[model samples]
Every structure is written in structure tokens, then in C-alpha cells.
Target: MKFTVAICTYNGQDRIPEVLDGLQQQTNPEGIEWEVVVVDNNSSDRTAEVVSQYSKNWRGDSQLRYVFEATQGAGYARQRAIQEAKSDLIGFLDDDNLPKENWLVEAYRFGQEHPQAGVYGGIIHPKLDVPLPPYFNKIKSLLAINNPGSQPFRYQRNDKPRKVPAGAGCVVRQQAWKERVPKQLQLQGRDEKNKKTLLIGNEETEAFFYIQNSDWEIWHNPAMEIWHHLPSKRLEKEYLLKLSRGFGLANHKLRMVRLYPWQRPLMILLTPLYLLSDGYKLASYYLRYRHEFDSDLTKACELQARIGRFMSPFVRA
Candidate 1:
């Protein structure tokens, strides 16, 4: 079976090389027909030039190709990648994500073994450039650093506080995505041009919701793994708070996607109940940790997220 590795980037000229290097060092991909496609999402930097230069001297068995996507948004870029891909199985990697040497083989093997799986993701360990902040574990998920133990398991579809795989280092069945996901998603991820205004996320989760609603299942494969490089800026309180709020804002839309059209009104009516619970938690958290709130980035992020969720019903889809 053929496979495609798609790296979606925006102004990631400096970070894309290391990811390419990781792909180049794959251990055992002899029989597998795989190629790497870099989708440049309206980058203002020298990303195109760097990928072109690398493609000229790429030594891996897989051919390196670059595709430019004029429309800005992670969702758009990924959609373009799916269309341009030559293989039915596509693995997505962010420009900053570095995979292990056996990532390609393992990811492909898992997909081959499980035809029922529409989407699957593996462990993501953080490669931090800065020191860990107080209560880092509480907000580490915002950075897409996930390690859900060593065993592989299918994600429960009916679980509250739903668990979905992060876009980073995740593999998808092209047929599943094409059949279920819409051409234009409500949550389009962060747009570079409107960086200050747009913070809404969960474009991938929205897609997963549609896929899981069908006969497909989502799984977590322990054998495949990647390291997400986190710079100091991502660890800053401001960025973390913004990320938390973005995720919270997307929660309602995701909830609506999972429910039937008839159940949406009930979900909307239940929004106040969710807000009340979140409000109590936020207030209690502030009261208990008033003194440490300033320094405790995790608590601050949680409060911001709660506030975002409270305002989610009003936010336009």
C-alpha cells in the first residue's frame, strides 16, 4: 500500500528542515511506497525557497514535493494535501513535529492492520526549549503533547469531555476524510493574516466527529511516536491563555457537530448549565489560589478557558 506524509506549514522555513531530516532517517520502509508533500499555507517567508532547495538534494527513497496553498488556515492546507496526495493513507505532521526513525513503518503497519480505524495518533513527547512552568502538566495538552500510556486503544465515542487525536503526528484514511469531512469547516484554525482576531481551533476534532459518527473508529497507536518542539514563546502565559480560550470557544461547535440537528436546541439550552459549572470552578479556583494565580499559568489558563466556554454560545460558528 502507498502512503503520503503531509507537512502543513505557515512561515515555517526555519522549522521544516529538522522534520524533513527525521523523515529521511526512517528505518524500514523497503516495500512501502511513500512520499513527502509539504503544503506551504500562504507563508510570507522563504519557506518555498527552502523546500525547493531541499527537494533538489533530497536523499530519501520518497520524493519530496512542495505545494502552495493560497487560502490561509490549517483546514484548507490539509484539504489541499488530501487532494494532491497520491496515496490513500496520509499522515500529517506539523513543521515542528519530529518523528522517530521507525515512525513511518509503524504508522503504516498500524493502518494496514486496522481497516476499521478512520484516524489514529500516537504519543507526543515535548522537546521543550524552556523550563517547565508550575503545573505544566495541567496545560500541556494545549501544546499537543499527549502520552496516553503504552497500550493501544480505541477512543470512546460517547465519553464526555471527548478524547480526540491531535492533528500533529496523526494518520488518516483519505477515503474516510473525503467521505465525512466537509470542504469548508466552521473551525478553520489560526489564520496568519488575522492572527490577532482569530484564536478558534479544533478543526481536526470537528472532522473526527463526522468520521466517528459513521462506521469508522478512532484509535491510539502506541508504537508510533513523535516529539513536538516547544519554544519559549509557546510556554509564555499570554500564549497559553490564548490557546486555552481558543480551544474552549471551539467546544460548543464540536458538541453541536456530534449531536443530531434535532438535539441542537437542547444542547443550546444546556449551555447555561455548562457555563454555571465552569463559572463555579473558575470562581473557586480564583478564591483558593488568588495569591498564586499571577504566577500559576495553569490556573490562569483554566480560568480563561472557562470564560471562553461561557461565551461560546454567543460566538459565531
Candidate 2:
């Protein structure tokens, strides 16, 4: 097969239909074989039943398959998708992500052209239900929405701080993933089922780090695009702060994953320096926005992320 679209979702019974409908509208390339697989990540809701209903009358050229992943994390669900996929190239979409008509063709074409790219992602535009805050753009990336530019580019690891594609609207080569990524990642991603679970993330970045360590390149493909639906709940101050903190908490682990064994000791020693830097940023941000801090959700979220980063070392994975 040419491509497999893997939708990983948990408790997404209400959200999966829109994504499926978007996929059904894809402008497929002639003779290009592709299929869609919905991996249910241990949902307590009727996610399976919803997919099952679709499978009954699925009229698309591609087959719609359902797989259950008992594991609770996004990483595990994606890993399961890779194992079950018949295609060498896999495009991932969260249940809330809706692709444009040309998204699949663009994603497949990019992979064909760039054989060296182990993993790549495209522009994610937010489809917010509520009015965006004035400063929402400041922390919008925390919501997994990004647009590097109109041009496609390779992400160089040598850049001061490394950057990798978010799992949403991302495509990965099966070979690279099977060879480089470990079955179990240090960060297992968020468990929506567990209310008290730490909002730890970076599972996708961790896998990308392994793939990047090899000869494969990571890229940003602007041609491929998707709309990430953001409900009002996600815009709430509490949710955004938690999301930021989760990303921050996973920062240290990702740093360690990207480093060589010899480099880890030095990274550990530099923990104090990192903490001081994060502390400075936090203090400076608070000082600048103290008057509006309570009302400024974006600023408050930034502060929470900084705090998470400062405490990352002490927090066990």
C-alpha cells in the first residue's frame, strides 16, 4: 500500500465522525493505494461503536479498519498503528484534526520526494469555537498548532534548541520507526482516562529524536495542512496551563533522550543553570504582567510551563 492514515483517539466518540468525514473527502491520487485505521486507545465511551457504524457503510476506495490498543498513551496507540499498517508511510491524525481535501496527496507526495525524511509534519490551523484571546498566539503552539512558513524546510538538529514535528498531521516512515524508536518511551503521553495523571507529553518528540539520530531527516511540509478543532474547554485558563506544564515537565526527559550517554552527565550538572534560566524567565514574565496576570491566560500559562521546567529534574518520569 502507498499510505495508511492512522487516527489515534481516546474517549473521542463525539469527535471521530468529523475526522472520518474529512478523510472521506480526500482528493486521492489516481492509482495511489491508501487506507484508514482508527486505533481506539482504551476509551470507556462508544468510540469503537462509532467506528463500527462507519465501517458498515464505508464507501471510500480505502478500507476502514478498527484496532484496539489497551495501552492508555498516545505513544502506544501510534506504535500499534505502525505495527498494523500495511503501508510503508503512515500519516497520523488526532480525532480532532480535520485534513484538507489535498492533505493526503500532499503528505504522500512529500514522502515520495524526500526519501531521507524519516518524519515530517505540516501546517495546523486552529478552528476555535470561542473568540481567541489577544495574546493567544503567544502560547498557541502549546495547543499543537504551528505554521513554520509557506515553504517546506528541513529541521536541523544543530539549531540552538532542537525542534520536531507534533504528532498531529505528522507522517512517519514505517522503516525508520521500526528501526529507531523503542517500544516503550519514557514519556507515555497524556492519559485522558486518569484525571490525576500528570500532564506529561513529548512522547512524539521522543520517537522523533530516535529517528533523527539516524540518517533520516525531519522536515516541515507546508503543502500538507489540517484544521485542529479547539473547543471552548481547551481555551479555558486551567486547561491551557496544565497543557503547558505537561509539555514543560517532559522537557528534561526529551533533552536527555537527544543526548549521547557521555553528554548526560554534563546535562545533569547543568540542571542548576537550566533552573536559573527558567527562574529568570518566570520572574521577568511575572514582573512584566503582574497587573494583568490574573486575567491574562496566556501569560499565566507561560509561567506554569516555566515552573514545570524548573521542577522537571525533581519530578520522576
Candidate 3:
């Protein structure tokens, strides 16, 4: 089976080399084909040039190609990668993510076994560039670091939708994307030029829901591993607050079906109660973890998120 591994970047020139090197070292099964496609998300730096250098010097079994996506958001880059991909299975990796040696092979095996699966993703351990705060352990999930388990489980149709596979280090099936990620479901990720604003961005998570609704399954594979590099700036209070609000906005955007546009106003009206409930929950979390974390970062995030969710209909829809 052929595989298209996509790496989306914005001003990631220096880090792209390590990610490319990791892909180069992948140990795919003999005769199985794989390639890495680097999508430059309108980078201001030499990201394109660096990737081109690696592409020209590639000596591994996998092929390497570079695509310049003039669009400014990571969402646009991801969509372009899907369009440029030629394989039945498309694996996504961020510019700083370093995948394990057997990532491709394991993904291929899972895809072969579960033709019904829509997406597959695994652990995202932190590769910190700075010291972790005492509260870091209590709030790591906010950082997008996930480690579900060490087994593979295909999701089933349950009352509540299954948990979304984390966006990083995941492989998406072409059939699933074609069925779910059409124009109706497309959502913009971050806008690189406007660095100050935090917009909605649970794009991959929303896609999994669409695919599941289309009678497709989502799987979590523990064997597929990658490192998510986190810098000191990301751990700051201001950035964390923005991320919290972004999460709130993204959650609302991901679930609000424009097909039922009439319901948006109702949701918007009920936002206050939801935020109040969230406030109560925030208090509970603080009471539970106050000894560990001194600040009410999580509480502030929830309030901001509720505000964003209330505004999601106007902002994204």
C-alpha cells in the first residue's frame, strides 16, 4: 500500500530537518511504498528551501516532495496535502513532530486490517524545551499531549461519540475524508499573519465526527508514537488563556451543524447558563487541585471558552 505522510509547517525551517530525518529513518515493510510531503503554510522564513534541500538529498526508500500552499492557515495546508496526496492512506505530522521508526508500517497494518476505520492516531509525549511547572502535570491535556493506552481499539456506535484521535501523528483514510471533509465540513485553523488572535481549531476532531456519522470507524493505536515539542512561550499564562478560549470556540464550531442553522440562536441564548455551569465546574477543579496549582488558569480558560462558544455561531458559521 502506498502512503502519503504530510508535514504542515509555518516558519518551521529549522525544525523541519529533524522531522524529515525521522521520516527518512522509518522502517516500512518491504515492498510497501511511502513518501513525505512537506506543505509550507505560507511561511515567512526559509521553510521551503530547507525542505527542498532534504527532498533533493533523500536516499531512503520513501519519496519526498515539497508543496507551497499560499494560504495562511494550517487548515489550508492540511487540505492541500489531502488534495496532493496519491495514496489511500494519508498520515499527518506537524513540522516539529518526530515519529517512531515503525510509524508508517504500523499505520499501514492498521489500515489494512480495518477497512472501516476513518482515522488512526496515537500518543503525543511532550518534548519540552523549558522547565515544567508544578501544575504542568495537572493540566497537560490542555497542551494536546495524549497517551490513551498501548492497545488498538476500533470505535463503535455509542450514545456519545467516541473520543477523537489527537490530530498529530494520525493517519486518515481517503474514503473517510471524501465522505466527511467536503466543503460543508471544512473549518479554518490558525491564521499565521494575525498572530495575536486565537481562532477556533478542532478541525481534525470535527472531521472524525463527520466520518463516524458516515458509518466509518475511528481507531487509536498506542504503538504509533510521536514527540510534540513544546517551547517555554507556550507555557505562559497569556498563551494558555488564548488557547483556552480557542478550545471553547473550536468545540462550538465543531458541533454546530450549519445544516441546522436555526438552532444556533438558541445555543447562543443559552450560553450564559453553560458558562455558569462551567464556572461551577471550574471551582470544583480548583478545589480538587488547588494544592498542586496556585492559579485559576483552567477556570479562566473555561470562562473564556464559554464566551467563545457563545460567539462561535457568528465567528465561524
Candidate 4:
């Protein structure tokens, strides 16, 4: 089956060139059909202009196209990609992600070979615009830096199913998106405004569990790798807290989604208990890092996320 490299960008004219360059560098085997589809999610900048220029310069068998998703969220852009993509497998690369040259080729090969896995993801290392902070290694996992080792395996950690695929460098089958996600699940993801200010968002994470429940297996293909750009701004204590809160909110939403309609009422009754459990976990982490400069960030983030999750029921879709 052919593969579609789907990059979601919002006001990314400045940051998208590297990602486009990475795609232009792809080494495709003859007869392998693939394409690059960039979903411009309501960009205020010249993101479309940059992509249009690159489309003319694309050299590989993969054709480049620019799609405009007027919606502001990444989830909406992703859903648009699902519709716009011509291929069965859609490999997602965030706007700032710099994929390895073989990313497209390996993704196509892996999806072609592994029919059982509906979704597959690879490693994501940090592409830092600034020097790494001394405390970075302590929270790399939270930062979305994933290695999962050089050995390829099914999506699992310590013999349990992995929670979510890496945000970027994730290759998902159109079949899975069609079967598991009938439509974009409420479009609860980051907007440019949120990223700049609140930082509260979880665009794709919640869908992982929904897809898994549909019996679509998830996998890790080590050969498919990308570098996710982490600017100095994202490395700040405040941003981490915001991201952490987003994670919590997303996790709660995932749990809420798993409930049957009949169970939601009872789940509502049990919400406090659930939040309390999360609170304890947050407290434990806080105590562990309390002396550090960013000690309270995680705890505060969890609190904010839990609050958002609890309020999710009231939010109109």
C-alpha cells in the first residue's frame, strides 16, 4: 500500500522549511507510491506560501500538496489529512519535526509488511534550537523524546500496551482512522493561541486508546525516526507545567471515553475518587522534586488537567 506523509502546520512558515527539506530528501524505491500532504491549520502567517514553493521543488516520486484546514486545532488538521490522503497509510510529522531521509521509505515498508498493526510509531529525539538544560534528562520522557530501543517491537512498555504513539513520526493506517475514529473526536488540541499562552492541549493522544480498543494493533518501527524541534521557550518551567496539564486533561478524557453510555453516570459519581487518585500521584511527584526550581510545575499541571478533565463533560462539542 502507498503511504502519505501528513504534516500538520499552524503558522509554521518560519519553521516548516526544515521539515519540507527533510521530505524532499526522501529516498524512495522505484514504483513505491507516496506523497506529502501539509495541512495548514488556519495559519495567520505565510505557511501556505512556503509549502507552495517547496511543492514545485519536490524531486521524489512523492508529490507535495498544500491543504487548508480552516479549523484551528491539530486534531481537525489531522482529520482533514485522513480525508485528503490518497494512500492507505498516513504518516504524521509535526511542522517542526525533521524526519530522517528514510522515514517515508521505512514507514511504507513497515506498514506494507505488518498488516496486523493499524498504527505504528518510531523514535523522536529532540532537535534543540538552544543548549540542553542540565535537568533535561530527568524529564525527557515527558518532553516527548522516545527511543524504545533499536529493536522493533509491538507497542508496549514492561509487557503492557503503550499508552499513546509518539505525537510526531507516527504512521497510522487510514483504515484504522476510518474504523476507530469515525471523525475528529471533538477537536480538543492545541491552537496557536493556546501554544503561545495557555499551552493546554492534547490533539492526538486520546485517540490512541480508542483505536486500540477497536483491536487495531500498534507497533514500533525503529527504522522510522524523526527529530522534534524543542525551542528554548518550550524548555521553560511554565511551559512544562502547561504541557503536563494538557497530558492530564488528555488522559482523563481518554478514560471518560472508554465508558459506555450507561457507565458515564456512575463515572460521574466516581469522578472525585479518580481525581483524588491522580492528586496523590501528583503529590508524590511534587514531594520528590519539591526542592528543585520546577518542582511545583508537575503538580500544578496535573491539578489543572484534572480540573479541565472534570469540566470536559460541560464543554459543548
Which predicted model would earn the best TM-score?
Answer: 2
lDDT per residue as tens, model 4, 1-317: 37788988888988899988888778876568788899999888999889888877787576899999987777788899989999888999988899998888898889879987888889899888888887677567667788887988876422443466676889988888788774758535777745532323455666665676666788889999899898898888777766665555555556666654466678877778876776676666557655763455544555555555555444444
- Model 1 misplaced regions, further than 4 Å: 196-200, 275-277
List model 3 lDDT by residue over 104-213, tens digit each: 88888888888888898888899998877776765677777899888888765453644777789999998789877765444676776668345545777677767766
Stretches > 4 Å off in candidate 2: 283-289
Candidate with the larger TM-score of 2 and 3: 2
| RMSD to truth, every model | 1.9, 1.7, 3.5, 3.2
Per-residue lDDT for 14-98 in model 1, tens only? 9999999898888864568788999999999999999999888886567889999999888889899999999888999999999
lDDT of 2 by residue, 1-317 (tens): 89999999999999999999998888876657899999999999999999999888885678899999997787788889999999999999999999999999999999999999999999999998888878778888888989998999999877777889888999999999999998888888887777533545578989999888878999999999999999988877788888888877887788888886678889868888988888898788778888876887777787788778877777775
For each candidate in turn, the TM-score is: 0.94, 0.94, 0.86, 0.87
Off by over 4 Å in 4: 156-162, 194-201, 258-266, 280-317
Give the better candidate number (1 or 3) by TM-score.
Answer: 1
lDDT of 3: 0.76
Number of the predicted model whose lDDT against the real structure is largest: 2
